[model samples]
Target: MENTHGYIPSALLAGGIAGTSVDVALFPLDTVKTRLQSAQGFWKAGGFHGIYSGLGSAALGSAPTAALFFLTYESVKHFAGSETHWSPVVHMCAASSGEVGACLIRVPVEVVKQRAQANRYMSSLQVLKNTVAAEGFSGLYRGYISTVIREIPFSFIQFPVWEYLKKTWSEYQKSEVEPWQSSVCGAIAGCTAAGITTPLDVAKTRIMLAEKDSLLSRGSIRYALTVVHKEKGVRGFFSGILPRMMWISIGGAIFLGVYDKVKKTVSKYYLKKHDHIT
Candidate 1:
């Protein structure tokens, strides 16, 4: 087995491929989850159809974001291993760095996707144009603060938890476990994290997508929290906690498992070629 503590460019390459592929495959579900999170009466509007609108925008947004996240994460992990210690703190820091890098690029795309999902009638381009015209370039980053808040903890928990679970599971297996097992563990970790962070996500989504005249007009984090508290109290902030957890768990599992498997496969192939050359 390859040492988990060494630099591995092949893993980063593989992780990128896996992450992008999984995002493309599972984006429709993500669109559904986001709609459910953002909408006030998501179920009453049109049931699943209402919730799953604008999947196309989600697909576009998720692909690049997932790719960058996995690439940055794997690369960071490899580089961090060069240090003397590989403690939990190191892992957390590495994961945070990766998440921050991914989110920087992802925030604009998320705005576009959220806008499209929030308004079923609008296309991706229409959302972009309207946002640019009204709010200018800054408008594209509507919920950046919330995004960062959500991601830092989310990534910090996600990476190390997944690594721990994968390692533990591998030890129990008679042979190398399949990718599906890793995916399952990833899903569990994702669900746990999503549940813990649901309130923050709700606040962020509302702030980003609120109308100009609404009480959330300023798009400030404080404004968003106040709106939710007034409208639905503290419970209001966790509106779609159940569904969000379910979807995130599933999505997380598939995403992480695919990333690990792809990276492992690529590394294996590359190593074999190098060995033959030597």
Candidate 2:
């Protein structure tokens, strides 16, 4: 059996690499999604131009945020005996906890990233400086609550589905899943989650990209959603659904695939080294 101690380091490194890889690789898609969801409309929000505008902040934040999330998620699973039972509830809880922890870093990053993506700022640093100067330090965390609200539900759906799919495949095949299989499972789960939770995502994007001092910028999820509904109707809630689903689907595949591959490799190496010492 693998030692529990090995999981921590594996989770950290694998999560970091996976996060950075997916974010940097799919940043253009994410930028398009952000712009599509922007209140200013697509063309006004830079409309496919500067698709890589926020790549720096996304790259910088992805590693740490993903690392923190997986660290929390794996720790919770290990402690909760998820390896033995692998309950969906446990997966949901672990994913939720991971989202909560990850969002601390993620929200600030998203604020800069989405703003840059919308062409409001030329660079991550510029966005950061202007936001702080205008809205104070709290500006960096503009959509913290809304983001958590969006992410938790997304995790509630995605992680449980991913775990269940992997488990089912493993049972059917009578072997552990390949990283590519995990990627497929992750893509399915992410796409499903993205489609269902699009309204919440739009709400988060609206809150983050809202003008300073605007009602939307006040960060009330309900009010922001209400305003969106009032302005654009139900369709507004799904503004970026296509790009969102596409980005997340591809992103999930790369993210989870890389994570599984790196974590397994690192864990196996660590176990072998440990056995040698013994």
Candidate 3:
């Protein structure tokens, strides 16, 4: 993490790579989770249970959304990265801020992707056209608020734990930690955060996947809870929890491993070039 520190552009590139790679690789899992969480469950969602459904939209949005997140996060962290006393707070704030930028791009893509996963639309183009025609441009951002709610805490929980763990590992190892170390830290944090946040995630997905003007379309946390509770009891809120946990846990490894690798490669090249210049 330190090697990757002090560089904003590097973070953008690494974040983009990490975000794109994980989302693309785990997209099938995401599709399955979304389908399972739908009010209709897996059977009612139609199709031949194609796991990779709607991957295009997800991958498209993932790059920029994730890039923006790291760009903002790294930029903020750079200012306070070295401040041990302020490390956790800095990581928390930076991660929270990062999600704001991420959500702008992510929410729309998620809207399209989730709908496609539900078999509401066959193509990304169709999802976009129909969404705009149905709810105008705003329709693309249908679950914007809920996404922030779900994502911000995820970043908050993940980054602090990641930062602390990285610091501890570096101290214990008496050397710069390797990418694999970062991957393990990231996996643990991702699993913990995703597990804790499943309820909010469930709500976010339900609201985003809801049809226009439908009862389920309400984006309020309260609405999501009511629907889940009234319909399937406590279990409804945890419907797709298993698939999601697996996706996130593994996705965390891929994301952090790639992010650290890319960060090292990029930063080393530039630093070496700068040394040659000097």
User: Which 10 residues in a row give candidate 2 its minimum summed lDDT?
Assistant: 1-10
Is 1 or 3 the stronger prediction by TM-score?
3
Candidate 2 differs from the real structure by a C-alpha RMSD in angstroms, to one decimal, of 1.3
Question: Per-residue lDDT of 1-278 in model 1, one digit per residue for the tens?
Answer: 54453225555565556555655666566666566666455654334664445555556666566666666666666666624446466668877777787787678888887777667677788988998999899888777878888888887787678777776787887566678888888898898888888888887888777775566645666778777788778888887787688777877877777876776676677767777888
Kindly give the number of clashing pairs for every candidate: 1, 0, 0
**Residue 125 displacement (Å), model 3:** 1.5
Question: Order of candidates by TM-score, top first?
Answer: 2, 3, 1
Against the reference, the lDDT scores of all candidates come to 0.71, 0.92, 0.85
Taking the tens digit of each residue's C-alpha lDDT, what string does model 3 give over 1-278? 46543367688789999999999999888887888888788877753476677888988888898889888888888876746787888989999999988899999999999888888438877888889998999999888998899998998898899878877999998987789999998888888888888889889888988878997676897888788899999988888888888899899888987888888888898888788888
**Candidate 1 segments whose C-alpha is farther than 4 A from its true place:** 1-13, 43-47, 50-52, 82-85, 174-177, 213-219
TM-score of 1: 0.86
Native-referenced Cα lDDT, model 2: 0.92
RMSD of each: 2.9, 1.3, 1.7
